[model samples]
Target chain A: MKTYTRPLDLKNGRVDMSHGSGGRAMAQLIDELFARHFTNPILAEQGDGACFALPVGAGKMVMATDSHVVSPLFFAGGDIGCLSVHGTINDVAMMGAKPLYLSAAFILEEGFPLADLLRIVQSMAQAAREAGVPIVTGDTKVVEAGKGDGVFITTTGIGVVAEGIDLKPSNIKVGDKILVSGMLGDHGVAIMSQRENLTFETTIQSDTAALNGLVATMLDAVPNIHALRDPTRGGLAAVLNEFAQASGHGMLIHEKAIPVRSQVAAACELLGLDPLYVANEGKLVAYCAAEDAETLLAAMRAHPLGRDAAIIGEVIADTNAFVQMETVFGGRRMVDWINGEQLPRIC
Target chain B: MKTYTRPLDLKNGRVDMSHGSGGRAMAQLIDELFARHFTNPILAEQGDGACFALPVGAGKMVMATDSHVVSPLFFAGGDIGCLSVHGTINDVAMMGAKPLYLSAAFILEEGFPLADLLRIVQSMAQAAREAGVPIVTGDTKVVEAGKGDGVFITTTGIGVVAEGIDLKPSNIKVGDKILVSGMLGDHGVAIMSQRENLTFETTIQSDTAALNGLVATMLDAVPNIHALRDPTRGGLAAVLNEFAQASGHGMLIHEKAIPVRSQVAAACELLGLDPLYVANEGKLVAYCAAEDAETLLAAMRAHPLGRDAAIIGEVIADTNAFVQMETVFGGRRMVDWINGEQLPRIC
Candidate 1:
């Protein structure tokens, strides 16, 4: 094996154009930094790509990709590194699949600090370690100083869904109950606090987490679940709207039934934002037959990541396919999809 | 299905932050732009992730990723769009696998022209079509203007290698012959020409292409091929060094036998670059037992992409693991791995 004469100056060094040059500097970075942090048999092989046999009896393969251009790389609870992993894992898990592996590609801006890069990478390694999904293959590129943000990480995940487990929005049927795994808007509120430099008595941390374990528990408890989706990007309202549009049904939810952290709600109110339209990195929305809703909620609440689970709504027969919320005061209004950018680069 | 009142104005539109805000604007862009160009059954489902069953006879799975941050979006022959698909496909193909599907993630800069984005997407769809690989899922994120270049694309490919066809650098034998599929340095020279604004008598065009078909042909003729790789970022020299270090052997090549177009050589000379150190997107290197060399070469020559194929070198037993080239004038010198950036963002 090739060896570097000296170790990388991780503390004082900055990312230069050479680090992405595909030469000695790039090789050293891979060997000393990436390879060391993401140690695995497949990655250690250092082939152009990673090769592995699918586990016997594994079902259909599911693939998902997400680009993390989140501003303020570091938020209250997670950095872009961990967010990159958790975000895609949840996407695959939403399909009722077991995420097996991940591939990462990075576009780094020239002159970014190596120390920050190290911190981000370490966070990713820790997240992947906890999730039991190895990042088996990756690529890196660098743009001129002014041509890029500090860094953008794009992660792609591969998973397998066991036979007879189908979770699609089209499977949603009228009279099905809609449940949320946890509180909404924590991630979005956390990010907003950071961006606004808001100081609240209670700090709200982004709820970035890998939800595969929670999903597996729910699937075990209710194998006939119809639809599952993470409340990301456009949050609970967006997910409900998607379900309504896909299934040609209306979504009816009680505003009082949804779970939201007091601090998050206060933050949203102060910022003139609605919690329904805010994003959540860790929470998921599920649909099941009315009889199975209690069992599903119990399974979700038992999981560490889903302790605040609740059945918040139900699908209804309506020609307009609207998502309406019954207010706490007994009046109702539509919980429509967001119209424009509330926050940019909010993961 | 939800419908947009007006279609995306591809001719006069520019990407804005809302296009990535996971709102109505983002949905419209996806519905009218991405969904229209990359139309396939899997993508038409509009799920967060794409799901499919692996072929029954498919062997081990292969996964590869590449991030294309090429300087100019468009070049003489190909742009970053086709290059992104070809780059990842070639990486997966180098593993002796049949590429099955692709997932793309794009980081677009706010204020980037929508027309250019359309061109890139159309190019990507066309490339994927020509390669018989469908882009099953994708993501788009827009950064604030000036935070990113016009666009950066990262593509991840999944493939399956048939049983009994293993290709790895460690498989190379000391006496194996090394073969190159076609000419070298065309891609580097082409990009350099654009960057330098040098108009040559004969314009140099990038050689970016998907090599899966060519790879399939070679494998059919010589299933015992020892090693295979696409000479991409660090070009021929980097690949040779990688092979030598992995196999604990040395590489010895005759410079006269290497293929380089006259224009490419002139451009490299003007740019003070060594053709051996320049990048080639479509080219590949192969290592085979001496007995199978002729058969592999014959098969490669019959392929359109390998008409300029040649046996340029051979592996040798050397404890130091060096890469050397015999000059056309009979003098020998070492072809060392590149030490610094030659061309940044050269796909």
Candidate 2:
């Protein structure tokens, strides 16, 4: 093992156009940074793409892609690195499958700090390691300084789904029960706080966590989930609206049953943001047999990432496919899809 | 099917932040443009990720990802949209796999022209259709105007590699022959000419193509192919060096045998660039047992993409793994890996 006597100036050095020119400098960066952190037998092969053997007798497979352009590279809780990893993984897991491998492609801007790049990569590696989903293959490109954000990551995930364990929003039944794994609005609130330069004595951290483990536990316990979705981008309201539209049913959610951290709620009030429509990365909504709701809720609460899980709503038959919520003060309000997302680049 | 009464003013409107806001406006753009062009059953499902059934008893799976950040979204022959699709598809095809599905993620800058975005998406869809590969899933994010170039695309491809047909650089052996599928530097020269505002009498076209058809032809004609790679970013020199180093051997390329178009040669000459190091998008390099070289060459020549194919080099035993070229003047010189790539974002 050899170490450079003079390593890259991670503190003060910046990325140059040549680093992505597919030459020795590019090779050195891959060898020292990407390959070093994302080491595995498959990635080490370094072929045009990584190749590996798959498990015998696996079932159907699913693939998903996500582009994370979150503005503030680093947020209160998670950075874009882990968010990229977790987001794609959760997409695959939402189908009730175990993610097998991932491919990450990064676009970096010239003059971006190497220190930030390294930090992001290290976090990406850590997320993959924790999720048991290694980044098996990846690509990197660099654009001119003024032509790009510091960095943008696009992660694609592949996973295997066993036969008869399908999860799709269309499969949702009118009588199904809805459950939230945890709090809402924390992720969007945290990002907004950072961007608005609001200093909170107790920072509201983004709830960004991989959901496959929690999903596995729920599947093992309940065994009859109709659908699962992470409340990202458009958050809980968007998800419910989608489920209603796709399944040809209506949703009746109870506002009091939804979980929201106190700090997140305060930040939402300060920013005039509705927690119901704000994003949450670590949370998920599941629709299942009414009888299985308690069992799934129990399993979810038993998991560390879902201690505050609760049943939030139920699916109802309606021709218009509307989503309605009962307010805490016994008034009704429509949980309609917003004209535009309140938050941008919230991931 | 439905059409917007006042459709997005594609001819005059610009993409605003709301187009990626993950709400109604974003939904409208996806429905009117992306969804309309990429119309398929899987895409119509519009879940977090598209899910589909795979053919039973398909072989081992392979995945590849590439980010296309080529400046000037529209190039001489192809735009970034089609290039993104072909580039990732070729990466998978290099492993001798039949590409099955593709996923595209786009990062568009706020204020980018809506007309341009539609044109690019249409091109992307056409390319995917022509290649017999469906873009199964996608994500779109719009960054603030200054934070991104007009657009950047990252595409990930998944293919099923039939058993007993493995292609890796390590599989190359001494006494193997190296072949170039077609002329080099066309893709790079074509882009450079447009960038430098040089109008060739016969406009040089970017040789961006999906090579799976040609690859399939070669594999069927000669099943014992050792290694295959698309001569892309770092060009033929990089591929040859990688093959030599991976196989722990050396290469002796014949400069006289390597193909180069006159216009490309002229461009390279004007730029003082070596044609050997310039990129070719639609071309590939193959290393195989020397005895089968003629048969493979015949098969390649029969394909549309390989009319100019020729045996450019051969492998030899050398611990140093040097790549020495025999010039047309009967002189030998070392073809070394460059300190950095001569071109950036050529793909």
Candidate 3:
């Protein structure tokens, strides 16, 4: 309970081994950095963990986890901090649940700048606050200098699904209509441009935002939606393929209808990457009954994060579970899973 | 749904960027290693997250997280994988909860051997199985070759406490008794010996274990337990200081009553370390009413993990909230907070 003799030098200080030594230094760092930004009653208790009553009518609990090792911790539109929070929240939201809490675990390299750490924590707090989900618990560990990059953040989210809303890959029927929440590949292209130092006629920014609110809007309009997922690491190609395989069906989509901003499309073309295989951080693919497709699309398009929502595909019967796309050039090609590493540390 | 053309070469394979790209290689590694080991019904779904019904009587949920960055991934008695599981489980159990599930997120360094990764995952699987807590969800990310050490594992646990049990540091009264579960410094000494290449007359092993069962037994007998915590980092001294600070009281303990194995004590002595500030992986400290201390100690001793349980200290009224210990030679010394790092990456 005794305060440290000197305050942390956030302006010019750097993380050291003592910051993670489970001693006074660690306590000081927590009090000054983490607890200050993530100000919540539960975290203020500073117990071994956070304990709270599960929300009532919590028919089922959803848990999701993601580890962000994005290079160049700061990106165009977002940094790893907010991305870490949004990514896991979207995962839980994909299950037709309301995300309630998040737990963050940070692995920081020794000698990393404390200023950058503070910035990241502040962004995370803001993102969590905007999403209405507090980061209730967290942990911090420091690795030796060369043993780690600047930092890697792992976030786990807990959400509660309402009684009658069940969204799963198995629920996708052969005739379900497939719709995308927004444009594809903005996140990947933005990160790629930053890494390659490429200049484009137009600037590209990562489409990293929490999708829980958008998902809630869509689900409210179409509660019986069959399945939903965010196209993150493996992009739309991976998600479609996963759904096809899980449902023992095939997908036939119109590439022309899939929303892709011209800048992202041009960037992917110049980089020799398929937009289908590029990541999207703030977008989702939803499957619903054919009769409800228009209603669901209207709901999604009304949300800012899903303004470009479009129906791009429909499920079909195919024992092989192939995802065939009708190209914009009036041809068809199998939009297969990504073959190898198009991008590493792309979040 | 289609299997890879070639099975993963688990023996000679080294993780490359492709293994974490959310592509075929990543799928192959997951299918061949992680899925094969941590086999459970929930993880088998392989959704974005795992969704399950909360336990019916789940009065409140407790969540805890820890990131493991221990040096020499493998040690005498445990590896980072099992240590990560036991550490978080103990945290949740310290709150008088029954740990129900765990989520693991791994940041693997590129070029790390797949064999070692498999070993760690196997150990994690066995530990979770033995503890009766399933690893229900997880994620994996790869960093460029030199950007990271072999691997860092972060585990988050979710548990449900019974209706009447409410354990928090604020519950510690001025007259509460403090008891330690078992011998101290075994874990720290074991790791120190490995790092220092010190050969002792007696082999010392890390006391890494899951203490949920032991916690359940003790709580069953003493539902009114004031406070409980596991002394991991910063050891017993840190726990006492934290308790004193949090409860606005001082802690006075008899050094003679505290148990320390001779080998561990000798190792600490040789290393110029104090047993009081050395970590223990599988131990806990509990606070109870003075009159119930004997019953609590007896209940703890009846459990296998608490064979050496002893009432080592008592909370006293003190304005400064200092933690003082009575030495065997009739001298009193302040067991103050650790000011600097004793051992880095000791966890």
Candidate 4:
């Protein structure tokens, strides 16, 4: 077997027509990179579509689909491949389900670099493996250059939710406790550092990790959690506003309780972006009964991804659906719904 | 109920901030346009998300998701809304399934005309109803102007594939008959004609439609159809190429047997486009046993949408995986895979 350990020349190489040609080159690329990294039985089957038996269960299946179109394809701390898997998995997990399978569709620019695409595919496979999900089936298409950005990925995920665990915004009560899984705005800052002419020096890596394990741990600890939401594109503020409106309740938060890394806060301050509105890929907002707050917080903190978790707010009775934050300086300020896109294509 | 009879001033009106302000203006827009058109029980509920029960079934369910980002928002015959629904429903239906329900996620650019958005939504709802598929759930988010185009709609569809159908490309045989549902290239041409500087003088309307009913009729006529595919973005050429590769067989298409309208052919000639590479939203390609081809064609022609149905070709024995077309002038030519984008922003 060939080791295929050559590092890709990312700077000068451009994608060529041969990459999409289903020949020896395509086979070499798939075997050396895709197969090597995505070492699962289904992918190894090498069929036009993967076939697998569903897990035996009485639970209802939850399904979700997401498309990834982030610019530059390769981002700081993560790329489109991992982002695609993380996104759909989080969508399914947000339903308080165990994500089981994923289907990916790729729209490749005809001249997209084969090396870069291989790397991206490898990253996606690794992410899926870490999340304990399988890439069950996929479709690939080559679009003409300039017709598409380098690569666009759409992923659809299916998961199973146990019976009697009805998690919905309708389940939320006025006295429910709101918790943040970890630090905010890291993913946003990391992407901002890569933008043209807006360079900043910070080791802020994207918080783009699979959160299904953390979600499972939290759900195991508190099965009756009212609702779970991942703050992705529009960030924590947008999520809170949606939750408040959906649950028909007001939210009061202690700004000090929300965890934000110092570097992220500093970068946001420099960029004139609000940390609250900046995106976070590896974090979630959990709402549960006030009595289960402590138990949930302890369970969340025990997980690797949720060590800095904190009780951020509480739901209150009000048709206004206002989300207010008590500033560290002993004053309250309204955390309004995000007015518009804070940073385009942050996801 | 206030009836809205006045035609929309699409050309002169500019979108305003009030469109997204969630006030009386928004209500008028929703009621006069969206609600008036959609008129479904679930949408009438007017919750943030529509909730409904799934139909009982023992068949394996197939789900597909698609996002529409076509330029010009409104097209020749349809807009993003109908296209989004049709696209995903066609995806699920291609798997030999009965499309059941859909979930839509809308990312609207702030300052988009409330009337335009409503028009698109209403069109989508109408399309869903006409197909007997329900829009059961949805989410809407408003992005700031410049961060997005006018609007982008993502639709997720779920359907159940009846047992014993066994539709797969792997089942395609060397002697299988190839059948095309209708004339090709109308949808792609209609979109290209509206492009700036690529002006044309033809009343070409898009063939954008949901194909579930047509598929159902075909399945009823012949359940053992080996493979079914929709020739959309990369058109008939791309789809045939994929099927040929998947089945590890060669395909020979008869040019005279394939259906193409005069206007579509003329437009493709004028623009240097191959009709085989142009898209057909409402059409489909079916492969089945040659003995059953006549029966399938008869059932297809009985339907309104498939009146122009034809037996285009047959699979051939070849490890080279070629798709060859017989020329109109009695010569053979390769109906090779599309190399580049024919027209951009075409759904």
Candidate 5:
């Protein structure tokens, strides 16, 4: 039975096994870190699960989940905290749904620095608040040292689409156009640069940002959008290849039209990698009819996240459903689905 | 190009970093393990997110999430997989909701055996099927060796409660009767037995099972149940204490009336642990009107999950809101919320 008037030791303290023990220490940590940062009415209720009132006709609800095990924990543009929130939010937005709420589950390693843990938690809160979503519920666990990294976050997002909006790859037609929101490979390169033994990076920060606002703006201009996808894990190439197979249409792209930052491009060259197949955290790819492409591009360009947007490719009729990319030197090469892992733990 | 006409090497294979690379290896792992087991219509669509149609007036939806980081991977009666699914399902059911779907995310260690991973996945699929819920979406990540345990899973569940059903600790009244579903301390003992340095002989095993159906059956019998909770992390003592504080009332319970297996009781005695504070994975405590207590007990006893249901406690009016317990030796003691962690990583 003791009381003290000192703040939590987040500067030089480490998370021991007791922080996640579901007792006084765990409750104290939650109160000082999670509850203080994620201050919303729903989360404040602090029940076993969060409760919310859904409107009568909110239409289809979409759920997406992603586990962030990114190396280095912190990167140039963002850390695992914000990346976890942004990743799942983008997944929900790909369905043309308004991201509504999120749940975060953290697995912390024993003896991890408490200061770093608080930093990540605040970053997640900031990201969720910026996107107008709340971390309504969460769970935390701690494993034995060496049994886990500093922390791994699994974020699950729930969103609701209006009654009339339908976005799916099956809606792609032969003459549809493809566009990307911004440059690719920055997020991946930023992490690779910080990895052990890799050291060639020149201001190639991660393009990690929540793209739900951009999606909403695009929908405002083109409600009849065909398909939308975030070029995340396998970059623009992975998303485009999936779209081709899902839609049963061939895709032809001009490599010169694709956006790639000069620094990231130089780094890819030094590492003998393909920027087209690298990862992105904030960019998106959209497929729409030829008539709506210009208007959608204009709308996307107006958004800060999609300023460098361009129509990079078009859908075509082909029985083989190949994703063909015209090289900058004028030869066409088949951009096949990656055979193995291009980049490990890219997201 | 190498194609092997054989199944994946679940027995002898180790998970490399490539398994989580979001490329061909990752897709193969999903197809071979996760998709093959969690076969449902919505999951087969394989979009970035899972979309579901919500009826117009389906009432309030409840979402719950939990991360399982149990040590020793496999324990008596259940492993992390079944535990994860049961844990989240019970959370939603505690709100008197019927679980509809679940999403799982896995973080695996780089060099963990593939066999263990598959076993956990299949167990999860079995648990979901038994609960009549589907695993509609999932994500997987792998960390470096020594950066993770064998695996950690986070399961998030969504459930919908019918109109006119309300269950909350806030509803408890002074004369309300408290009922427990079944035995306690078995699960905690079972886990402790398998810890690195602990060993004992006992038939007490982890009581990991889905309780949504039991919740439904009880609702059919007594729709006016005031409160519901599963004694998982801090056990029955923790739950009753929470109820007493939340309802602004005191609680009185008889130690002799509580159900505990003799073997489990012996284990607790040997381990110097109290049965009231040990966790139970598949038990529930219900608060209801004193007049309806017997009928509700009868209804619960008819269900397998609650065969040993007993009325063990009652709510009382006390300004201090203390949980007073009457021991078998005819002595009274105050059971307070645990101060520090009673048990670390007990769940």
Candidate 6:
């Protein structure tokens, strides 16, 4: 048996071609570093690919993929590792499904610190465990230094949705109630502050989280929910506009009802940003029947992940399919769709 | 009817924040640029997202996502636009499925040319239509100039695999015949020739193509194929090594049995690159039972896209899981996995 207690020389060492050479050096690195940290039955098999049995079911499977390329790999609350897992898992959950397996492909830049890679892989493993999702299959490729940033992660998730539950944007109807899971703009603001070298008296942490539990609760309360969307990149306003346009209906959101933490609001105000258009990693937007709105809100609030849940808007019949918001002072304005990238490289 | 055409000053125009600000300018850009080129029933609906009915099926659905960030957006044989669509569609098809729909997300640099963007979008539409896949839903964001390369495309594809087709690496066994779809190194050599400013008497064009049609033919001929893989980034050697390790088998490939174009070979030689390890955009590696090999090979050769198909190797029981080649000169050497990203951003 080989003793494996050596500390990784993360500081001085740089990733070389050998790391991807598919030789003894590559195998050793995988065994001593990645495999050790991401230990699981499937990954430990040490095969070129993972093989496992899928649960027997007639349910429809939902799959989604997302790539993470946020600058400054490490952020206030999460790094690219955790973001990679969270982003794809959220995408799968948004389809009203239970996420099962995840496949990750890493594009690593040569000269990247091995210790840093270990940390990221470990974080991804931890996130997967917490989300109750397995990292089943993966690929790793190292690009030369100048050709890549520190790291880029592309994650694909597969999930199964039980029959009789067909969720679609077209399912939304006039008078549908819209509810938000929690505070907005935290993740976007936290990343921006770190990247722009801005600081405030009160620290802002990213709301990077897995929302499958919250989704499960919402589904339990209202099985026929119209639609579920995670307001990630382009935030609340963008999601609402998307829903309205997709369903061919207008939306009326109450600005006072949408949740935004004070710190996020302050940061946005100082930076001349709109919290509504910023990103949120942990939060979700759910549209349901007005009759089931309270039941859904209560269920969301009951979950730890959705403590700040609130009824933010309602759907309306309009060919224009506009998304309008009632201001805190009672003025109505359009909460339009975002046209371009908000904060580039935002996961 | 309104008639309108404008000369685009790509060099002088700079994108302001309003381009993504969800205002009139954003709407105009989308209508005049993106929507114009990507005109289709699903996209023309102008919904925040797309809604369409899936073909009736109890078949399993396969989905894959890929991000394209190749430099010199327009390459030797294809641009980043078509590459994005082709890459993900091939990923889904490699599972022995018929690709259905695609979703694209664009991250455009602030100063990128609208005309260039339109050209790319047109190419994407053409490729998607040619591949029999629809671009259903998409998201676009513009990053500030220094924050990103000119453009990055992330494409997601969804496909449906027929019933009873169980393809997996675990299905691979000793004595399994290995097949290469067509010529190798065309894509890598073409891109490198352009990148390195190397000129040759014969211009090397990339073999960038959609392989779903070829896959369907092979599947119809030999339904019990063990595994199918595309030799893309790290190329034939990487994929073969992966399959060998996954199946716990060694491989013996005859160099003469592999197909390569003369120009590609010359380009690789000049660059001191191995054709075995160089990428091929439209090629595949199929491992199947020896009994079905002839049928599969005939089917592949019949396809216009796979006229150069060849039975290159066979799987052998070995704990080492090595990939070895029998050279044309009767010499034996290892055909190992790639060490690093060969020709970064080629795809």
**TM-score per candidate, chains pooled:** 0.99, 0.97, 0.99, 0.82, 0.96, 0.84
- Per-residue lDDT for A169-284 in model 6, tens only? 88999999999999999988888888855565347888999888888888988899888888877788877876776688999989999899999999999888899998888989
Superposed Cα deviation of residue B157, candidate 5 (Å): 0.5
Residue-level lDDT of model 4, residues A1-347, one tens digit each, is 22223543444555554333333333444565556676777665454334444445536666666667676577788998999899888877888778877777665666687678878988998899889998765545444565456776777776777766667777889999999999999988888888776756689999998899998899889999998888876678877877776678889989889999999998999999888888888899999999999999999999999999999999999888888999999999998755434676565
Candidate 6, B1-347: lDDT as tens digits: 11224533444665554555443345566666667677787676553344444446536656566667766688778988998888888887887778877767666667777768877888998999899898865655555565556777777776677878867777889999999999999888877767645555347788889998899999989999988988887788888877777777899999999998887787788788889988788989999999999999999999998899999999988788889999999999998765444566666
Better of 4 and 5 by DockQ: 5
User: Fnat of each prediction?
Assistant: 0.88, 0.76, 0.89, 0.00, 0.73, 0.05
Q: CA lDDT of B107 in candidate 2?
A: 91
**What is chain B's TM-score across the candidates, in the order shown?**
0.98, 0.96, 0.98, 0.89, 0.97, 0.93
Better of 3 and 6 by lDDT: 3
Residue-level lDDT tens digits of model 2 in A1-347: 22234566768888888778776667667778888899988898787776766546556778899999997999989999999999999999998888899999989889999899999999999999999999999998888889898999999998887766878887888889999999899899889888846565347888999999999999999777999999898789888987887888999999899998888888888789999889888989999999999999999999998899999999999988889999999998899877765998998
Those runs of model 1 whose alpha carbons end farther than 4 Å from true positions after fitting are A196-202, B196-202
Give me the candidate number with maximum DockQ.
1
Tens digits of lDDT, candidate 5, B211-279: 999999999999999999999877898898778877889999999999999998888999888889888
Estimate, for each residue in B1-347, the C-alpha lDDT of model 1 and write its tens digit. Answer: 78777888999999999999888889898888888999999998888899999668877999999889998889878999999999999999999999999999999999999999999999999999999999999999999999999999999999999999999999998899999999999998888788745555348889999999999999999999999998888899999999899999999999999999998988888778999989999999999999999999999999999999999999999999999999999999999888899888899
- Put down candidate 5 lDDT per residue, A174-200, tens digits, no spaces: 999999998889998898888877866
Candidate 4 residue runs with Cα over 4 Å from true position: A1-58, A67-75, A103-119, A135-154, A268-274, A329-331, B1-55, B66-74, B103-118, B135-154, B269-274, B326-333, B340-345
Q: Who is ahead in DockQ, 3 or 4?
A: 3
Span of ten consecutive residues with least summed lDDT in model 1 chain A: A193-202
- Tell how far residue A190 is off in model 5, in angstroms: 1.4
CA error at residue A17 for candidate 4, angstroms: 10
Q: What is the lDDT of residue A101 in candidate 1?
A: 95
Model 3 DockQ reads 0.85
How well does candidate 6 match the true structure in TM-score terms?
Answer: 0.84
lDDT of 5 at A29: 75
Write down the worst ten-residue block by lDDT for model 1 chain B.
B193-202
Choose 2 or 6, whichever is better by lDDT.
2
For residues A9-43, write the lDDT of model 1, one tens digit per residue. Answer: 99999899988988888999888888899999999
